[model samples]
Target chain A: METLTIQGSPKTPTVEMDAKSGVIEIKGRSIPENSIDFYKPIVEWLDEYASSPSGETTVNIKLEYFNTSSSKCILDVFKKLELVYKKSGEKGVVINWFYEEDDEDMLEAGEDYQSILKIPFKMIELEE
Target chain B: MTFDIEAWYGEINKGDVIVNHKGVITNDLITEILSIVENKLIERKENTRIRKKIYNVMVEALQNLFHHTDKLPNETNDNFGEKFVTFVLKKEKEDKFSYISGNYILKSRVKFLKDRIDQIKYLTHEELQLLYKLILNNNEFSDKGGGGLGLVDIAKRTGNNFEYFFHENKKDHCFFCLKILITN
Candidate 1:
C-alpha cells in the first residue's frame, strides 16, 4: 500500500489516501469536468488496498462542494470501502463526514450519503 | 434595447421567488445563488429525499454554467468582464423546479454542443456515471478540454433530460438556452 497524494485545484479536490497509514482524506471543491476520471484511480487504489486489509480504516470526507457526478464518485468510493469493511472481518471502517456548522446543504448532503451506504458513517459538524 | 426581462418573468404564476442579482457572477453571487436555490428547494415543502436531490441537481447545473461560460483570453479582471449568462428557476404545475441556463456561444460551436447534449440525454444515470469515470480515468485526453464530463455530471444529477434552444443574435453570436426540470 503506497501513499497517493493529489493536490486540489480550483475545479478539483485534494485527495490523500494512504493504505499504509489507513488515513484517507478528500477535501476541497470537486466540480471536475470528468469526475469519474478523477476518482477512478482513487477507487482503484482503495480496491487494491483492500487486499492488504488494514486493521482499521478511517475515510474523512471534507468537501466544500462537488458536482452531481463527483457526488456519485464519492458514493462509489464509499461503496468500495464498505466492501472492504465487510470482508476484512477485523473491526470495520470508520467514515467521518465533516461539514461546516452553518452549511445546512453540506450537513444534509452528508446525511444523505450516510443513509444510502451501509458503512458506519458519523456526520460531524465543523466549528470552523 | 431595453429588454423587459422582468416582464417576461412576471408573467409566470408558479410562485413568488426572487433572486438577488449582484450585477456580476462572482464567487459571492454563486454562493448567494446556491443558498437561494437550496432554500427554495426546502420551501417547496418536499420530502427530505426529493429536496436533497433537487438541491444537488441545481448546484451542479449552476456550477457548470459558472465555470464553463466562454471566457475572453488574458483578461486581468475575471468576473467584471462580460457575463451574458441567464439562470431561470421555475416551479412547474407538478411542483418541480426547472433549472435553466442561457448563455452566449460561438455560432460555430452549436453542432458540437448539440451532439454532446444529445449524447448525454440518451444515457441512463449509471451509464453516465460509468462514462464519467472512463473519461476521468484517461488522462491523455486532457489537452482537448475538461468539460466533456460536465455534461455527464449534469445528466446524472438532473432527473430529466436536458432541453436546449439556440437563439440567433444580430451580432452573429447565438444564445444557447439549456434547461433541465427536476421533479421534487
Candidate 2:
C-alpha cells in the first residue's frame, strides 16, 4: 500500500499513515471550517487500508485541539480501524493517545473514545 | 465610564488579551485567531490539556459565529452577506482564561438560541456526554458543520454557567454576546 502524508495547516492537523511501519499518526490542530470535507480523503484512505492492513497496527492521535465536527470524523476513522482490528486476530490495532501530564481534559477526551470503541487505548502522558 | 458599546468592548478586552477581533468573521480570521491563541497558551507555559479544552471551545465559538451570524444588509443589493463579530481571549486570573464573542442574529431566533443555551446550562456532566454522543453518531452535522453541539461542548468544558448579553440592534436584529471561561 502507498503511504499517506498530509501537511499540517493552521486550521488542520498533520496526518501520516505508513502501512510498512504499521503506524499512523495525526497531530496538531483540527478545526477546519468544513471538517467533513477536510477529513474525507483520510477516512477514505483508512477504508482502503482496511483491506490490506499491517500485522500490527498503531494509531497515534496527538491532537492539540479538534472541533466537534472533526471529533465525529475521527470516530469514523476509528470505526474503520476497529474493523481491521476485529479481523487481524492476535496482531490487531493499538491506539496511542498522548496528552500532557497536566492536561486532564485531553486525557478525558481520549478516554471518551476508548469507552465508545472496542479497541484498546494506551493513554500516554507527556511531561509538561 | 460614560458610554459607547464598542469602546466598552475594548475595555473588557483589556489586559493580557491573547487574541481579540471585532469585525467580519471569516474562515481565515478563525485560523489566525486559533494560531494566536495557541501561541498564547504555549507562552504561558501551561500544560497541553487545558490548552486543548480552551482551543476546542474556541473553535466551537468561532464556528458558531461563522455559521449562525446574520449578515448586515448591503447597499449594492447584491446580498453579499457579511456580519460583524467580536472575539476576545483574556487571562482572567492566575490560571483562568476567558473567551468572549459577539455577533448579530435575527430577533425571531432569540427564543430558540436562549432555549438551547438554557437547556445546555442545566444538563449534568453525564447528560452532556450522552447528548453529545447521541448527536455525534446520529450524523447530524448541518451544511455549516454544526450539529447543535457547540453550546453543549462549551457548557461541558466550562462546567460553569455562561455569561451572555443581548443588545437589541433594530426591530428585527440584535447582537448575541457570549462569555466563556476556561480554568486550569
Candidate 3:
C-alpha cells in the first residue's frame, strides 16, 4: 500500500497512483521525449502492484495527446491492468477515461482503447 | 531543358517564412513554446481541460511535420535555399486563436495523402475510433506503409474535417499546407 507520482512534460502527463486507495490517475499530454524511459517505471510499478493488488482498483486516464510510440506504451499499461483484472476475477479493475465535451478525438481515443482492452472502461465527458 | 528559375524560386518560397519563433518548430523550440502557451493559457483563465485540448492539437501538428517533412536542412540546392517549417499563432478579430503549419512533401505521395484524407472525412467519429483500433491492433508500420490510425485522431482534433492545400513546386516536390482550427 504505497503511492507513486511522476510529472509529465510537454510530451507526457503526470502520473499519480495510490496503492492503498486503489486510485491510479494518469492525466496530461503523452508525447514523451523518450516513451520507453518515461513509462518503464510506471509499468514496473503497476507490475509490482498487480502481484498483491488491492480490491476495486480504479485507473483514471485523461490524456490530451500522445504520439504513436507513447500510444503503444499506453496499450501496454492497459494490458498489464488487464492481467490484474483477470487475477482479481469477479472484483476486477475499473477504467475511466475523461475527455472534454467537444474533444471528439480524445473521446474516440477512449473508445479505441476500450475496444482493445478486456477490462471495463467508462468514457466520461467533462464540460470545458 | 533549362530549369524554370522563377517557378523554382516561387516553389521554394511557397511556405517559407523567415521569422524567429524562438525556435518554436524544433526539438529545442518545443520547450519554449510549451511554457509560453501554458502561460498564455493560464492568463486566459482556461482550465486544464481546454488547455490539454490545445496542447494535444499543437503537438499532433508539430510532430506530424517533424516526422513527415521531406526537405533537407541548410542545403541550398534551390534558389530559396533549404526552407524551414513554420508555426504562426494569431489572434483574430473575434478573439479567436489559430495555429498553422506548412511544410514541403514529395509529389509522389499526394495520391496516398488524398486517399487517407478522403477516407477519414467519410468516417464518423465512432467509426474512426473503431477503424483506428482495428488498424492499431492488426497493422504493422513500415517506412513505406505508414498505416497507423494517427491521422484519424488528427481529423478528430477538429471534431470535423481539416483544411489543406498543395502548391506545385518547380522541383520534384510540392508544398503541402495544413491549417487546423480549434474553436474556443
Q: What does the lDDT read for residue B129 in candidate 3?
A: 62
| TM-score of predicted chain B versus true chain B for each candidate | 0.74, 0.89, 0.72
How many angstroms is residue B177 displaced in model 2 relative to the true structure, after the best TM-score fit? 1.0
In candidate 3, residue A49 scores what lDDT? 90
| Candidate order (TM-score) | 2, 3, 1
What overall lDDT goes with each candidate model? 0.67, 0.82, 0.68
Position B104, candidate 2: lDDT? 77
Candidate 1 per-residue lDDT over residues A56-103, each given as its tens digit: 888899987777557667777888898888886536689889987566
Assess candidate 3 and give its lDDT.
0.68
Using lDDT as the yardstick, the better of models 2 and 3 is 2
lDDT of 1 by residue, B1-184 (tens): 4233344334432364434231235545666676786676666665665555565666666666665555433442345356546666666655566666666566777788888888778887668756765664443333422434566755766643678888764244566677677754
Expressed as tens digits, the lDDT of each residue in A1-128 for candidate 2 is 88999999877899999988889999988888788888898989888889988889999999877888888888889989999999896468899999877777778778888888888999998886
- Candidate with top DockQ is 2
For each candidate in turn, the TM-score is 0.59, 0.88, 0.72
True contacts kept of each: 0.16, 0.71, 0.26
- lDDT measured at residue A41 in model 3 versus the true structure, 0 to 100: 87
Quality class of the docking in candidate 1, CAPRI style: incorrect
| Clash totals, every prediction | 3, 1, 3
The weakest ten consecutive residues by lDDT in model 3 chain B span B15-24
lDDT of 1 at B68: 58
